[model samples]
Target: MNTRKALYQFGYRRSPDQDRPTPAHHPVVVVGAGPVGLCTAIDLVQRGVPVILLDDADRIGEGSRGICYAKRTLEILDRLGVAQTCLSKGVTWKVGKVFQREELLYAFDLLPEDGHKMPAFINLQQYYLEHALVERAAQLPDLDIRWRNKATGLKPRNDGARLTVETPEGSYDLDADWVVAADGARSALRSMLGLSFTGEVFEDRFLIADVKMRGDFPTERWFWFDPPFHDGRSALLHKQPDDVWRIDLQLGPDADAKAEQAPERVLPRLRQMLGHDNFALEWVSVYTFQCRRLERFVHGRVVFVGDAAHQVSPFGARGANSGIQDAENLAWKLALVVNDAAPERLMETYEFERSAATDENIGHSTRSTDFIAPRSAQELRFRDAALALARHAPFAKRMVNSGRLSTPSTYETSLSTPDRDAWAGSARLGAPLPDAPMRDREGRPIWLLEALGGQETILYVSNGDPPPCSCRILTIGHDLIDENGFFEQRFDASPGSAYLVRPDQHLAARWRHPDSSMIERATRRLRGFDGGAA
Candidate 1:
């Protein structure tokens, strides 16, 4: 047995619902306690909504499933108060190099600028990430995480949903005002609701080997196309915590999955690639190319998140990163609806925004899949030519896709008010609000994201007092001082520039010398009350 499982496992215990005279009710019931489910439940509980998170297993599953957590995900974790745990134990990196054979095609830095709280990416084992989340969830009284509890059945309703849970002791029915199906790709709840996915499944496989070794390799992403050790196939290497290196080797569609995972076969490949025999295998698995998503993520009362809603190729680390974004996207919207602060139509925006995000992820994952594994001779020739040109030409280097790393999604939805005035900064109207360094009135340094918190805030960048508004007002020059001028440069903040930030830390709308009414209208538009025509 894996030591991580033994150390992190939670014993199955009977729930109060199992002994209740009637089906116990919860404000929200989250199926699957993976990263997504745990995050969703924790976010909801933090919002004052009681949540019951159920998982069939008691431990973080075997293998370091997803190791690359993007900076946006780290920001979400920061909001949830667990970013330090992940950062303390994860490998932080930003540089990545793509190579064709021994020749380096190009190298890219994910985050060229500084002053952000989090790095460009962190390579931590998924189990460690989940364990951190589970620990944080345990601190929230409203979040009840039930281990050894499998969601065997789901009945959707207009008001809520009824869940049939199977436990080690017995089966019991429970009621919830809303159900989150974060049960992974083969979601039992999704199946119970007779929902199916619609997308493509590429006919190629890859071997993921987590090997433990003390190497002098830098913490950088190194991807190779047709390397000498593994000719005619792609390979990738990433450093994880505990000196565990993740190595992925492309295996053709015809490769036997079972045989390839065997240590006898995997060891030889590693020996050739590393040119040494000082490594021990921690975990190994085989996976195929799959980029698919459900037609609709939201049903009547059941909402799907994470892999349950969409599955993308592991290349570019989009799988878990995108799923974490989905959980953040749903948590705030669902909280508002459940609290009656917003109408049910608010949840529909969750569907609209995240579905579009899924589409973008799928498109990128599929393109990366194609570029890594060309389907035909013509495609292969084009890819080879592109790689050859990438060695010298900058434009061709952009074409060399070794899985475009995951970035935050920009939602062009009704919740966001389109920009009326021209903006000169990276903070787009519908995109994530970029982070910068600032200081409070006391001159103590702070990060922009930490100051924003989780609220609909009006960021007025002026030395003068901000106009009164419905939402909280953060006066830039008064409340926060841009010590390095990064905030002003990144936001293009003139004296009277103002921005309306959403709860998820996204830019909803912005203006130049906006009045209280404009801020109110934008706030209403953000909350799904207004038509958002303006």
Candidate 2:
């Protein structure tokens, strides 16, 4: 009976100097090969933008870090052509339970609706995710993924940025019109630029351990507050693929992180929690919670994404999810800017939008941390009372904040054309379009997202003919069949309502009985051509 863990290897072949000469100038160079960097490069290359992706390491991540993938992230990955692989290799769950000292307090279902293409969340190891993304990236001819290519120096210019990379063979210099820094939290490029990363650092420490065992625990998130097994501390348990379980134990400020991570200390805790030592320890790490972000993500020609731009506590699963969204939000804008389809100011919107999202995630994560590990005795009393009352009262249950799960950020920017009509819909302007089940004209079952190509799409849900437009037109009830009535119920569609969707699938504007001039105005406003909102 073998219990050793198997690691994945993505062989790195040295690039031949004769065949891989440094280009005079590249359109884009991504400075990390993690999820965010790989996503950026894939999205750019799919849009006909050549990209050079550099990674300091040749192997996947060491552990199963950042295991939760939100629905919006799955949608973005679906666009990159690897969502199916992720879905197949991940554990899908939506229900979560909160307990107080062996007593169940409340339960929640993140996604209670049906007819959506993706679930609320999926738990897949970060290594598996990166492997799938790297495999997908390798299939693209426009993307050049260079392993073990470490960026040592960055020189920012008025026109572009020059990067000095160190490889196994030797050092080489490369120039790019734009540089994306998807590097980790301790980004060397970020340090070289001398930018300030400001935020709050909590004194609390947390122990994350991954154990492999044969258990019958259901695929759900279980959170405990002051559980009896751990003796007045918080704990979180989640099921992942390959029969691996992730257990997070909250350690007070006075506890030594290094000592707690030792096998002797960790095994006792596991035995107490599991009532036996049937599981094998796979990986363990100790970390302090922090909520921090750079002042600005765009540093002239060098742009930062993912952990390089922002970081938050692991409570809400926002770190990797937000970083991937940052890449999705920036890739299309960068492509448009490089191809001269939009103005340089378009890049500013990325900084503005993602910064706002980072702040939101930080705020929520901070609140969850405070609730989970209250510093003051008075705070703990209130948390206890809330958990006790949550068993019977619905209001108290809502007040219980274990982790306010991750969701897509809706941008409130000048890019979105203002709604011109009195509309009532759950999908608002500047928000990502809500997915629904539909059928294509050929009677094949499809999703609303499936019909939405990678461009500005116009969704008209009416009987009248849509206006003549340059973008793709999707007329519901005609071009697509509403088999489940989800469109009308979710979108609040009227007889002549029209929706303008951006390239990133966010709703830009909507109109009631809009003519060709009105549609054109909205398009122009979205592209930053029109001065006024449509």
Candidate 3:
């Protein structure tokens, strides 16, 4: 017996492409309508690239799968025009507390700084996110979302790929210049392309239960290692919207996954942990961790994103957050490639940067899993010692990883030009630009990121003499005045200093003082017109 309600159910409609005599063609076809696919479609369409989004399911599922959206993820959502909705409807949090057997250890803040438009994190049901994305997609005329349209077969080609899509009415052939496989972990397109993930799968099992009850629990992440209720096991608590709470409990490797999810078994565990039986189970499931990813995200004209490309444990909230980042990173480059503005090799950078990010995420996730679910007695002993020391020693607290939460990945790509002079602050080469409050030319308040737009622009600190450059330039003190001094402190800006920002908001290059030739050369390299890194 489940206590869940359907949020939205979209009806399937026959696409006119199926009625055409020959195979209908599209610029880009996104093979899944999940968050990643929707994001990919939305970003591409906003960039003037028409995208057809296909999903096998016509409705958002009842399960609250991904509840935590990181600050970086929220920023990307804001760019796509849906972050405000998520913030308004979801629970916002930044602090997390870790415990050992009912003993208080320590709490940590995810975001201690201010002057940013988004919060550190937000907890909203995956269904609500999908609904918001769907609503956004509807507003864009170039984004065509096909419900109940499933991709069944694929034929790879040099110019593009051909997909055989199956619908309730019948199956039809569709050709696309490029295909994005956001179809998830069990990707049909991945199998069709003969791709396999390479990594480790932990044997330990964990149960997730979303309970509904009215309580005064503060909005924060709580992780307990070997709590009193579940002796020798771990438990996690998180507040969600609508008086719901997410609980995760480690069930060891040998526990019966099927039996653990039963209401009778789940209810008892909740009663012991909560000291009452006032909660109703909304959703329950058991899962094992698999830290894995494809060797290459790009395969000819077919690209994989989200679970189709990588998989990570949910402990760190890395799974969905990383996937959303994948969409953003790929969207801008893919649009440029589709528009013939950049070389085909530009896609290689997407493959390189995102794969590096996946490896970083996998490594962290693997370490977290090892610490959380120690396989041997020696490993468990080490974990116990670390937890004991974490109570007092700050160094030991850093060692204890309940799950290091998700953060934006800085790409050390060939596209980023090496600095000509020493630099300081968090505005390093190949990092996402830190947001700061500033005033636009009209004296209106705006964010540093909001003014960058979706193009490579030059961020120049002005001394009343701007550098001569052919690229778009946003001159500080002229276009945007940093009244709060945050932009100056965050970027270590000085008069005549300039920074090149990528379309995805990452730093591409910077210099203390640069001429027109220097700016043009770096722009060429970033555009993939030049060969080696500058």
Candidate 4:
């Protein structure tokens, strides 16, 4: 027998006061210690809100789950102070190739436009991601991470919420002014609240295996439809750190998951795909795709985020990426509400914005699942014809869908003040501010996102006097100059144009000319005050 422990087996230290007290009150109590939960805790702490995070498991995730992190997710992680660690430990890839049998149908690059700080995507194991987040959370004094603490019961009150947590030694009660449910797809808190998810559960099953090997396979997303090695099925290959490759093999609905996972069956498939059996399997799992979400994420003082609120197929890497974005969207709003800077109604926008995002992800994931595994013969024939014509026709190539890919959703909410004048650039209200490289006041190159940090700010493109505002002012032509014209070209900014940005780095409003009253009105609107454009 092999006497070696698996990789990423973190030590579990017994938590303090397992049976000490009851009715411990906290400003915020977050359930689950996965990437989304930890990210939420870190963000809240960074925003000056104290939080207690609870998780049943002491260690990180077991497998290389959710390996693909999108660019928008990276930017959000950047604000949480872990983007550099992820970038250093991740495999960056932008190009993806699609194939039908032995013929390469099309190749595409996700980031055709350049000058951005982060890449289109990066592949890193989920365990590594959680490790980095835990490390980052440790640096903040406001975040209290409790391992082996499971939330078994939840009771929502008008003024606050009460939770029952079970520890190794015993169970205890906790009172929280606000509760954030990041528990996951099979959330105990969600269940305790009697909430149910609604969406489609796909019939097709997929086998995900993380195999350790060394080969000349390029660091790119390679997807195959009905390949010779894997006859009558689809496969996806992605490169991750530590010489591990993620292979997702689509098994028919009726395939025996247990038999397919056995080494006797999996090893031969690996040998056939790689032309060798030199690789070692690190982890393997069988799962069916699901597109499900709660009708609303916010309930009284309790708020749901990440997998606890929504789930989607892993096809577009939307599962984890969208969850991380949920944390980003909720963190700042929660902070404002807790600090009394914004009314509790501001938190309701979290439901409106993220529910729309969930719908968008579920819609795309459902389409991708249908395309990859068509239920009807007519759909299969259409897919095959599209794949065949993609090799020769550009239009057909556009129609070919391996996966639609994940992108940030633009919110069309009452919070985003519409533009009063004509704008030229792609940046719009309620969308994240586009990043561009420029020279800082110290004559050092910095990305716009790096300069913004996590504060509400004003971006002005002018050499003239800046408008008087309480927020930080980023003067483009004065403090920072557009070296390569990226800032001007990307934002479509003219002289004296100013943009009001939220603490989450989203554009709240923009003006062709800097107007102090208008900017102040927009800022007030964001803080839940009345009398502003909606």
Q: How many residue pairs clash in each candidate?
A: 0, 0, 0, 0
Preferred candidate (lDDT higher): 3 or 4: 3
Write the residue-wise lDDT of candidate 2 on 108-164 in tens digits.
899998888999999998989998999999799989888888999999998899988
* CA-lDDT, candidates in order: 0.90, 0.88, 0.92, 0.88
lDDT of 4 by residue, 252-323 (tens): 899788888888888788888889988998888788999999999999999999999999999899999999
Pairs in steric clash, model 4: none
| Candidate number with the higher lDDT (1 or 2) | 1
Q: What is the TM-score of each candidate against the true structure?
A: 0.98, 0.97, 0.99, 0.96
Cα TM-score of candidate 4: 0.96
Better candidate by TM-score, 1 or 2: 1
lDDT of 3 by residue, 1-534 (tens): 346767799999988999999999999999999999999999999999999999998888679999999988998999998988999999999999998987879999988999998899999999989999999999999999999999999999999999999999989999999999999999999999889999999999999999999877799999999999999999999999999999999999998989998988899999999999987899999999999999999999999999999999999999999999999999999999999999999999989999999999999999999999999899999999999899899999999999989988999878988887987787778989999999999999999988986778999999777466967999999999999999999999999999999999999999888888888888888878885655
Query: Which residue ranges in model 3 land beyond 4 Å of their true spot?
Result: none
Best by lDDT: 3
